[model samples]
Target chain A: MNDSPVLRVRNLTRRFAAGVVLKSLDLTIERGEFVALLGRSGSGKTTLLRTLAGLDEVSEGDVQVSPESTVVYQEPRLFPWKRVWHNVALGVRTPDARRRAEAALGEVELAHRLNAWPLTLSGGEAQRVALARALIREPELLLLDEPFASLDALTRTRMQGLVGDLWARHRPAVLLVTHDIDEALLLADRVLVLSEGRLEADLRVDLPRPRDDGETRFVHLRRTLRTALGVTDKQAIAA
Target chain B: MLDAVLAQGSRIGLGGNARTTTGQVAPRPRRALHLHLGSMRRLVSPLLLLAVWQAASSTGLVSAQTLASPLQIMLTARDLLNDGTLTHNLAVSLVRAGVGLGLAIVIGVSLALVAGLSRIGEDLVDAPIQMLRTIPVLALVPMFILWFGIGEMPKILLVTLGATFPIYLNLYKGIRAIDPKLLEAARTLGLTHGETVRHVILPGALPDLLVGLRFSVGISWLMLVVAEQVNANAGIGHMMMDAEDFLRTDIILVGMLVYALFGLASDQGVRLLERRLLVWRPQAHRRG
Candidate 1:
C-alpha cells in the first residue's frame, strides 16, 4: 500500500472537435513525489493538466487518481461572493469547518484576512488563499495548473517558496504545470517536458533542495530541458 | 466551446465593473464639496418645474378643469386622507400589487432555477416560456377577463403574467453567464450537483436576479393600474376613474401622485435589498 503510486494514467487521450490535444499520454506519480510539467503555449501543457485534474473526459485512457485529489487553477477561482475562510472550507462540509479553514489559512499566512472577499485580495494574496483552499482538501494528488503564471517577479519568488514549504510539510504527490524553466528546477523532484500532446523528456531532478543556478548539474538539466522545449514539434516527435 | 468563450467574455465584462472606485474619475475634495449640492442638484429641476406650474395655476393661466393646481391637489389629498378613501383604496392597490409581485417572484425564481440548472429542464421549460413572452402581455388582458371575469383573479393573474418574464430571463442569463472556471473548480472540489447549485450557482446569479425583481416590481404596478382601470372595485385607479366622471381633476392628480410615489419608493426598496445582499461588491451600496 505504501509503495503504490498516487496517480497512474495509461494511454490517456483527449480530442476536441477541432483535433486531438493529448495523444495516448502515460504518466505515473508516486506518493509524496513532486513533478513539474513544462511546455510552451499550445503544447498540450494545460490540456494534460486539465485531463489529470479530471476537468475533461479521458476519451482513450485509463486514469486512477487517489481519492480527494484537487486542482489549483491558473486563476485563484475563488468565489467572489464568499469570504476567505468560506472559500477554503467550501469542500469540507463537516462540523468544525471554521477551525480547519482557520488552520489552513494560517498555513498560507492569511489568517488576518479570514473574512476578506476574493475581489479585495491582491493577486499574490489571492493565490495564497487558493493554495490554502487546495491544502484544506488534503488532496493526495494536488494539481497546480500554471498557478503562479500571473504574479509579478517578487511575489512569484515568494509564492514559490511558500509552495515549496507547503509541499515539504504535506508530502503530497504534486504535479505543477508551468512554462517557467527555472521555476520547474527550483521546486520539483522531477521535471517533465510535454509537447505535441506527448511528454518528450522526463528528467529526475536529484539536486538538493533550494537548487540554485550556480550548480553545474542544474545548468546542464536546464539546458537539456530548454532544448527539449525549444525543438520543433517534428523533431520532438522524431526523437 | 461556445459556452467557454461566452464565459470568458463575461469575465472580461465583469472586470470593467470591478475596477477600484477610490482613485477613479472623481477626486475626493471636489466630490465632498458637492456632497449636499449633488442631491439638491437632482431636486432642483423638479422643484423648479413644480414652482412654475404652481405659479401658472395660481394666476389662472392654466384652468382648474384642464389641470388641478398643485395647491388644490394637495388640499384634495388632505380631504382624501381625512375621509380615509385614499387610505382604503391605497391599501387595496398595495395588497394587489404586493400579492401579485410576491407570487410572480416565487413562480419566476422556481422556473429560472429549473431551466437554468438542468439541460433537460431547459428543454422542457424554456421554449414555452419564450413563445409566451414575445406576445405583448397586455393583449392577454381581454382574454383574462373573458376567462376569469372582471374579478381579483384576472387582475392578479395579469400582474403575475406581466412580471414573470423579466425575472426568468434575467436570472436565466445570469446562470448561463457564470464563469466556467468557477464551475470547473467546484467540480474538482468534490461538490455534488445540488451542492454546486446551492453554493455557487444561486449566489452567482443573485445580482441579475435582483435586477429582474426591480423590473418585475415596476411592471407589477403598471399591470395593477391597467387591471384597475378596466373595472377596479377599489384601488387608486378606481379613484382616478371616479374623478374622471366628476371632473374632479384634483383627485385624479392625487391618485397619480400616489402611484408615482409608490413606484419611486418601491424601486428604492429593491435597491436597499440589493445593497444588503451584495455586500461583497464595493460599489453596490454607493450613493451619488
Candidate 2:
C-alpha cells in the first residue's frame, strides 16, 4: 500500500450558537491506516467525525480528502422502505451493483438476508447490513461513528472481528470514533484521544493482524488509552 | 400442510423458506380458504342492522311514505340502475371528485414541500393557507357558484378548495417531524440538496402525505355532494334533492345508500394503495 496521506484536517474548528464544539483540531490519516478516536461523550468525538465526513460545517481550517469517502452511523439508517439487497446497493445502478451487494452481504455473513426487509432484521443484523452498504461503495476513506454501540456484548465482539476482517481485505483508510478503549486497541493502528474538544493524546500500536484480546500487549495498550483519557480502574470495574 | 408449516416455524418467514417446494404444500390452500371465511364473520353486524331496518319498515313502525321499506328502496335502486340514471349521476359525481382531488394533491404537496424546505417559503405561504383552510367548505359553495358559474367549473372548484388544506397541513407537519439524525446521516454520505430531498425527505414525508391524501379524498366526496345540490341537472346529490321535492322517500334512501357505498369503496381503494406502497412499514394496530 502507498504510504501517502489519504485524509488531512488542519486547524479545524466548529462553533454553534451556544459555544464552540471543536477548537483547533488537526488529524491526518495515511492510506490503509486504521485510526481510532477515543473520547467521552460531549468531548467532540462525534463532532470531529462529522466534520471529517463533511456532515457538519467547520468554523475555520481546511479538510482535504479523496473524493471517495463514506460514513457508517451508530444506527443502521437503512431505508425502511427498501429490502436488504436494495439498501446495500442504495443509488448505485451499475451492471454489477447486485453482484457487489451480494458479495458485500457475504462479507458481513448476511447473504441469507438478501431479500429480507429492514424491519425484520435483529439489531445486530441491521448494523451488519449497514456496514455492508458502506463496504459496497468501495470507499477510499471509511469513517465509522460507533457503529456497534447499541449491540449486545457478544454481537459487538463478533462484529468487531468481522469489521477487522473486512478492513484487512479492503485496506481502506479507516477513522473509527468510539468510546471503548479495548475496541480501539483491538482494531486501530493508532489511537487518538479527544478531551474537551482538543486532541489530548496519540498512541501508535505496532501489532500484528488478528491480535488476541487476552494478550499482554493488548491489555497494556488498553490501559494506556484509558489512563490517557483519565478513566480510572474503579470506573472500568463499574462498567 | 398448515400444521406442518406451523410446526416447522412459528415466526413469520423473512427469508424465503427452503424446505417447502411447490408440490409440498397441499393442505395450505384449504387452511387459507378457511381463514378467509373466518374474516367474513366481521361483516355480520352491518347485515343484521339492514335486516332490522327492513323488519321495522314492514311492521309499519314508521309510515312507508316517510321511512321507505328496504324492498321499495332496493327496487328503486334496481330501476335507476337499469335505466342508467344511477350510473350517469354516479359518474358525474366521481369525475368532479377525481378532478378536484388531483388538483388538491398537486397544489398541496408543492406548497408543503416548499414550506418544509425553507424558512422563507414557510413564512410566505403558511398564514394565508391556514386562514383559507379554516373557512368551512360548505360556506364556500355559494361563493364558488357565484364566481365560477353554476356549472362543472364551480362544482370542481368547490371540491378542490375543500380537499387542499388537510393535505397541505399534514404534509407540512410530516416534513417538520423528520428525525434530524437521519438527515445528518444523509449528509455524511455526501448527498446533494436535491438527492437529500428525493431519497430522504420524500420518503420521510410519505406516511403523512398518505394520511393527508386519505382525508382529502373523503373531503372531495363531501364537496361533490354539496356542489351537485347547487342548480345541477345530474349527480347523486341532485337526484336526492329532486326525490325530496317529489316526496319519493325510496329514491332518496337509495341515493343516500349509494353515497355510503361509494365512500366505503373509495376508502378501501386508498387502503389497498397504502398496503401496496408501504409494504415495509411495520403493521401498526391503528391505520391512518
Candidate 3:
C-alpha cells in the first residue's frame, strides 16, 4: 500500500483567549490519502486545518507537516485586483510562471477565464480558480476549509466530481474540513468525526470510485456518521 | 483538440450574440443623449440668474457701485487679460498651490504610511496630527506670520497645513481598512513584507488616497486665497486687495471669477485622474 504519513500530530492543543479549542488531539494523514474531518460548528475543525496550514499557533503540540502544504479557505480569498492567471501564478517566481498558471487553469477547465477578474466570476468558477491556485504549488498536503460550503448544490456536486478526478490524477494528501457527511462520504477514503476537541470516530470507506447514493452501504455509512455527529432525523431534514 | 474546438465554438457563438445584440441596442444612444442634456440642463438656472442680475443693473434697480453687471465683469476681465495682470497673478497663485500641495502629498503620505503600518509610528505621529487638525489652519495664520514673517513662506506653509490632514487621515484609514484575508493569502504565497505592501496594501489604499487628494487640492486653493490675502506681493488675493483699494469692484469680481474657474478646473482634473486610475471600480461609480 506504500503507507507513509504525510502529516503527523501528537497532543495538538490550540487555545485562544476564550479557552482551548483543540485539546490533546492525535492524527496521522498518509501520503496520497483523502481524509475528511467532519464536525459540527465550533468543533474546532477550522482550527485544526489552520494549524496544519501553519496559519495558527497551537498552544501545545508536536506537529510534523510537510513543507509543501497549501490551504484553500472557505472564501476564494483571491486578490481581487489580480487576473485569474496572475492569481494562479502568485506563489511562483519563475518567468514561465504565467504559462504554468495557464496550463493549471486548463486542467480545471478555466483556460478561457485566464484574463478575467475574480469579481466577474461565479462562486463555483472562483472556487475552481482557487483550486487551480493551490494545485499550481503542487503541495504534498492540501488542506481545504469547507471550500465548497458557499456553493450551490448542483455546482457543489460538479466541483466534488472535479476534485475527485483531480485527486486521482495528482494524488496529493488531502484533508478536507467539512460538516456535510454526504460530502465527506462522497470524496474521502476515510472520514473522522471531531467532537469535544477530539476525533470521536474514524471510519474507512471500502466503497469503489463514483459512489452512488442508491447503494445500501452508502446509506448505512451516512446513517452511522449522522448518528456519530448527533444529527437527528429532524435536524437532518431541517438542514 | 475537442476542448479547443468547443472553446472556439463558444467564442464564435459569443461574437454572433454580440452582433445580434448590437442591432437591438438602439435605445442606448438616445438614453446617452438624454443624459447629456440632463447635465447641460444644470446650466439654465445659473444663466437665468446672470440674466436677472444684468437686467437689474441695466434697469438701475441695482446700482453699478453695489454690484457689477456680468458684462462689466467680463470687460474688466478683458482689461486685466490685456494688461497681463490676470495671467501673471494666476500663474503665481498656481505656483504657490503646486509647491504647497506637492509638499503636503509627500509629507502626509509618508506620515500616513508610518502610522498605518506600525503601532509605534501611529502612537508617536497620530496624536499630534489629530490635535493639529482640530485647530483650524486659518487660526494658525497669524502665528505663522509672527513666526515666519509675511513672506512666501507663511503662505505656502498655510496651504500645506490645510492640505495635509485630509490626505493623511483618509490614507491612514484606507491602509487600516484593507482586507486581512488578502494579507493572509499574500503571506501564504511567501511574499516578503515589502512585496506585500507594494502589491496589496498600497493598491488597496489607493482609492481612499485619491479621495484625500481631491480634498487636498481644493484646500490648497482655499488656503492660498487666505494666505495671499495676508500680505502678498503677487497672486489673485493681491490683485483682489488692490482692486479693493481703488474700489474697482469689477476687477475684484474678476479675481473671484478667476478663482472659481481655477477651482472648477482643478476639481475636474482630479476627477479625470480618478477615472484613469480607478478603472477597476464598477463603471457606474466611476463617473465624474
Q: For candidate 1, list the clashing residue pairs, or say none.
A: none
DockQ of each: 0.72, 0.51, 0.35
Candidate No. with top TM-score: 1
As a whole number from 0 to 100, the lDDT of residue A103 in candidate 2 is 94
- Runs in model 1 with CA error above 4 Å? A231-239, B1-29, B38-42, B285-288
Model 1 chain B worst lDDT window (10 residues): B14-23
Error of 2 at B58 (Å): 3.3
**RMSD of candidates 1 onward, in order:** 6.0, 9.1, 10.8
**TM-score of chain A for the candidates in order shown:** 0.94, 0.96, 0.96
In model 2 chain B, the worst 10-residue window by lDDT is B14-23
Distance from true location, Cα of B272 in model 3, Å: 1.9
Model 1 residue A60 CA deviation in Å: 1.2
Overall lDDT per candidate, in order of appearance: 0.86, 0.82, 0.85
**lDDT tens digits, residue span B1-288, model 2:** 423432222122111121121112233678879878877886788889888988999888877778898888999999999999999998988888889999999998999998999999999988788777545667766778789988899998888877787778878877887788878766666667887788778887777777777677777777787788879998999999998898899988998898888888887787677666766665521232
How would you encode candidate 2's per-residue C-alpha lDDT over A1-239 as one tens digit per residue?
Answer: 55668899999888878788788888899988999999999998888887788767666998887678898999999877678998888656578889899999998999999998788899999999989988988888999999989999999999999999999999999999999888998899999999988999999988887788788988888888889899889998997
TM-score per prediction, in order, is 0.92, 0.87, 0.90
